[model samples]
Target: MAPRSPPKRVSISHSFTSFFLGFLIPCINAAPLGPESDRVIKLPNQPATPSISQFSGYVTVNEEHGRALFYWFFEAQSEASKKPLLLWLNGGPGCSSIAYGAASELGPLRVGENGVDLHFNEFAWNQEANLLFVESPVGVGFSYTNTTSDLTKLDDAFVAEDVYMFLVEWLQRFPHFKTRDFFISGESYAGHYVPQLAELVYDRNNDTTRYPFINLKGFMVGNPVTDDNYDYTGIMDYAWSHSVISDEFYHNIKQVCDFKELYWSTECNALVNQVFDIYSEIDIYNIYDPKCLINTTSSATANKIKIDGFKRVTILAGGYDPCYSPYSEMYFNRPDVQTSIHADSRGEKWVSCKDSILNSYNFSVFSVLPVYEKLIKEKLKIWMYSGDMDGRVPIIGSRYCVEALGLPVKSPWRSWFHNKQVGGRIVEYEGLTLVTVRGAGHLVPLNKPSEALALIHSFLSDEPLPNHR
Candidate 1:
């Protein structure tokens, strides 16, 4: 491993727009330059507004399917030390990380009014780490899932291979970050992505021949669906706990909802869907649903606000439904989330959540849970968090899995307090940390940005989260 070096600072010649705005203090600049003479430096909240001059060429993962995977990168303004690199993967076998990571999370910009520029996310994750967002497989987001069967039969291993190939070439293209500490982070289905890929990295690391190891430090997942059984069970509990449903409904679902059908047979899967639909329609729990339903028309502005509010609430609830996007929609309607990479005439709406991605392959046969177990046994660090309110895969399910791991409990479960009420709860056992964001649904970052950021910081630093009690 290379020696770790702290970032350096430098003066910027550019005029400032605000007290917060200044050129990246030269520390984050990827441009070739000398380390500054100063030992101490403060990292800016946002890099000075990036000029067109700073935009690097796009990293294209050209495959045979005629669809190309595109990735754009930003380097520190100065190259004083090797910074940790983080690769962000968006869930949805078909969603683009560019939409999630660039538009929403770590990017310096957001999409506004028909793909127009908007305010920067001062808390973007990239500021603290080198970030890479990938659009994977073939038909996902911009990535073209190759053979028709590959598209329909996508599995964890196939994604691991495509991503591995992309990284090998990506390193060849930008050798600078090859040795930098690498970590994988994602949400939703990416719960399966980071671990499978990390296992591949570990395998390559152990093998002296055939493959070379990629320097990977660890990985993180927010509102992940780690196990299918646990996810479904957790959702019901979340619905019940949050009054999305009734305890009776949860008990009834647990009793009558057949897992054998959902996991084993096609007929069973259909039955499970029927159950979810029946439960979703009228608050099976017999409780009033807090979520407000809105149908906006004509004005995109109205739609954006409504959708943003929905996402914010979902994230805060830790329960996710983005609620409006059709489960079958192929492309997101928002221009900012659109992909010039795979914009086809088919005109399908991009889906935020999908059963197709999960059902595409026989998860019953080749689930990545084994891979995560292997990684855990190897003592590789892993962190998993979830939004408490997410119905698809609630934080309760995450807790269930941790309990299944049977790792020695390191910290007693306690409420994570924030905003006058319980923000969520957390427990650390062995080296693993499991967190639930109060009021946050599936997409925690979109909901509780501060808590999510703070969690990521602590995870990245390998430290215990602060006790709010």
Candidate 2:
């Protein structure tokens, strides 16, 4: 057997922005905030004063290891105290929730194109629920650990434990939110993070000896990575059905590739690599969307070139800026911005997705289906949504994963409307509901904010997606 290569180091290139504005504020000592200290007075380059209260700081999960996770919280626009708390995570298994979940996707304020300013997102998720975004694990974003070995020990269990710890301590710091109905949401690899963490929270809540109950009512994930077998088979099928690859190539892959295998043969790897090579030319995240021509030098493209011997792709029509990733990296890395957010005081450079964390992250769990099965049996409200255009964790794969659950159909699949037009389709199962966001890609909120907002509103309300306009 050919020896496996060492994991490639992934680098995300920065797009330089010259615009700068000077803002001065009194220097406060860098420490995890008391309820008041964490309040964001103002952010540098903010286009307009914010109306809603925003708080950001670190919550130490492990005192011995000096491990802390950075978090940004936004209160609901109208009913600040009454809304449920919704924790949003972004899954790269290493991606910063602040970058994808906050800045680029559903945050109340979005990082502007120049990376030097912020703009209000009218359709932000906080419109319906208090939004919380965290840079989790020990090494992603501004979250850090004093012990370097902690980085190497990262895995699903490690992440879930630390995050639960963060939640416990965080609830202590903000005691009022302890009773709010809580729901966890994220996309991509978060498919793993969300369920695992939810299960952990569920188990802990049931423990009579445990302190500080987390009011976790339910969770929602989009384009989530579920079972390896289903995801693999679905990817190839989606690609071929979508005409992303030729029939000859698709048949060749079918002949040489066995999606059920734990490891692929070298020939399978070569065929998959060729598939990714073609995906490289397009924005695999959103196949129909134009590639961000601005930062062609970015190794972010290279980082996605191979997904452990499988390829992912998608397409979307234009409107959203594809350069949001680089812009987020540049904005968060700024000294003033970091200070305003009460991030790491040492001025450690921030990246949207940390390559080190991704490289070292132990992909020990092959499937989260069992966790889903466990949770489904409980009286928890679970919903899964997929961007139909997201090739990475395509709707096809999500459907397959959901189908594998073998739940009775509570509602037949039907078109759901938004703006008097068919937004996508929806169906309700015995213990789960699946929705599709039409025209959206991997990042649904970023790709289609209005529709995404509507979807979340429905989920939080426990109502079905609008069947008619």
Candidate 3:
């Protein structure tokens, strides 16, 4: 077998946290400072906000690494005290869930095109459960490490370990949620993150003597990159069937490559690049979404922007701009915003996905399928969904992977409805469920917000999706 080349890295802040115990102690009837007390005091460009309370801060995960992970929590809009909690992660092996998951994908407020304003997202996931987004593994976004080597030493196992500790400390900070019904969710590279972290949680949950059990119920992943065989088959099929590649190009993909080797063969390198070139001029993440027309005048300016991190490729926001990366850079860079969130005092530029970390990720499991199988057997509510239009992590690959899971069907595949219209398809196999959101892309919630909300709402509530009327 030939040596495999490194996989391409694809991929995502805030808070003031110094309140003397006396600060809260002064009140006549004061509640102890809980994690919720890390509430966001204000946003740099916040608009008149809704009623939901929000929080942003760091949770130290590794003392030796001087590592800390950042998180943002949006309490459920109503009955938050009684609602379940959902942890949202974004997969980059090196990306920030805070930037991509919270800000652009499903968070309550999105950055407007002007880059200085916030707008409400009607279908924000907080409507269904209290949502918590974390920037993990010690090198992404507001998360950081004091040791120099720690910045580059990140992988799935390390990420899972750090995240596990993050949850422990987080709940300690907010003891009330220690027993709250909790679930894990994420997308893309997160296909690796959610399962591994859940495995740790599951193991600890079985030990009754642990300090806290984490009330873990189950998990969900969207457009995940799972086993190479199934993913390759699905990605090729999606591209060819969708006419994103020429018949010749599609033939090249089939004949010139052994899909199982995924990412390190000299023979398939040219063919792989050819396939990627198909969407070079478009947003490959959402093949159907409009492309960003970046207007850079000089190399110096472009280089500076790239060095500045998240805005490396400037895609201006418009309404809920389908473009995800650029607006994050604009909004997160403000000194005032950083102060409000109590972000790093050094004023370091933020990057959505850290190249330093990805390059140094020497560790990762080959596949998370075994983990999923175990979780399913354990009777966890394992759900998976994909946006059909995403060329990056195509829905075809997602569906194919689900079928390969080898579980007996509990419910025949069928259409799900919302607002009396066809929203998507659903299938159940014993303990796991598979879903596809019609007309959506890589970022499902951002593409089809209403449908995405319905999907999550049904999963969180443990109910069958509405049938086609």
Candidate 4:
């Protein structure tokens, strides 16, 4: 067997942006340049404010399917060349990471309530790492497969293969980041995405002569659905614990249908509908977050907040407004926005989650625990986090999944803090770290930006979550 490659050394100094760090320093243009000269976004809302650069384009992942994945990259605010490269993905199996991740959660500019305007996100992850958001698998966001057949099926296996190729080809477009410390990150369904993709990198990196030797370090995920069994059980536990549903109903649902059927199958459709009916009053994504019933009407002013539920959520939460969804759709669907970002518009418009794709998606592996077991043996840095308020993939489920690994605890469960307040709670295991963000739901960065930064900094820096007893 070829000798395993030595792990690359990484620098800990991070780029800080106001979004994540409470302040922004001008980005130092020290990295080798590519794609910036052509793909810069002149957003219709805020055209000239940002001095920092961004890149967006397509990289063909499958030639036979004529499949190409779309990506948007945000360079760090400082020392661009030296920072680690972090890829961000959103779950939904059928969702666009560009919309949910870059637009609402951690992008430089978040879509305002009207859906067409923009505002700065004070906690964009690019402040600390070079952020790359990809629309993976195909048929999600701007990524597409040209197969004329009406059937659409994207499973974990195909996602891994296509994304692996996407990264290989994407490097050809921007070669400077090839040797930089690379990490994979995603949320929700990306729980599956971040790991499956990382396993490929971990396996390939063992090759002595693999082209471009991707300098992979480790990975992080938030509110991930790692194991279908554990995730389903976790959500049920979360709902019951949070008083969202009755114990009798929870047990009845479990007795009637498997969690895997929650999304598909008529076997338990009526029963699942019962659970959803109780969950109907709330935003299943962030149970506590107020709902935005409609998109903001097209308006002339960037600050003109929408009248419906979207703006109300923003006003009530005082941080993340669930209303960003409609606005993101509006902005991304614009001809100018598509042209500015060089988006492919084979589809009518971008939906945050593509229902058809989610319904038609082929289930490959129910649990990534085996993959996790192998990667753990390899000693890769892995962190799992959850928004405490999020019921969809509750912290309880993620905690149960990690504990199933049975890794020894390096640090006993404790509260971790930022700015002298309880940021979250953390428990460290021999091979992984588990975190719960206080008052945060599925979207940690959007809900608790500072804590999210603190968490990410700890992961990227290879440090323990501060022992704020």
Best TM-score among the predictions, by candidate number = 2
Q: How does model 1 score by TM-score?
A: 0.72
Model 2 CA lDDT for position 463? 67
The lDDT of each candidate is 0.56, 0.81, 0.75, 0.76
The TM-score that candidate 4 achieves is: 0.86
Error of 1 at 148 (Å): 4.3
Off by over 4 Å in 4: 1-32, 36-38, 149-151, 208-212, 254-270, 295-314
Q: Model 3, range 313-381, lDDT digits (tens) per residue?
A: 344332335545666766776677776776873446776777776666754455678998899989888
Task: Tell me the tens digit of each residue's lDDT in model 4 across 215-318.
Answer: 77888999998887678778778888889888898788678766544243464566556666788788887887776665434552232334653324444553
Q: Pairs clashing in candidate 4?
A: 19-122, 19-123, 20-123, 91-189, 115-327, 292-309, 292-310, 390-441
Tens-place lDDT digits, model 2, residues 1-469: 1112333332222221121010012124443423888999888877565576899999987787899999999889988678999999888877999989999899999998767789988889999998899888878988899999988877778888888878877776766677789999999999998999999889867752433467899999999999877887787788889888999999999999886676778998888777778878888788777766554124422312122333222223433887788778778877778889998735455778777788777677778999989999996889999888877788898999999999999999999999998999999999999999999899999999999998999999866678898
Candidate 1 global lDDT = 0.56
Displacement of the residue 208 alpha carbon in candidate 2, Å = 2.8
Give lDDT tens digits, candidate 1, residues 1-469. 0111222222212221231112112234363321222111211122355531112223334344543455645443333145677788877655667566655555554443232334455555655676677766556543544346655545566677667667766665555566778888898778887887888778767853445447887888877767666666676666667665566666766766554243345454444465467556542321233443433333422324334344332322332234323211212354433332223313444433334554454342223566766888888878888766566666677777777777888888887665456767788788677888766655666556667767777777666666664
Clashes of 2: 7
Instruction: Report the Cα lDDT for residue 196, model 1.
Output: 78
Q: What TM-score does prediction 2 earn?
A: 0.88
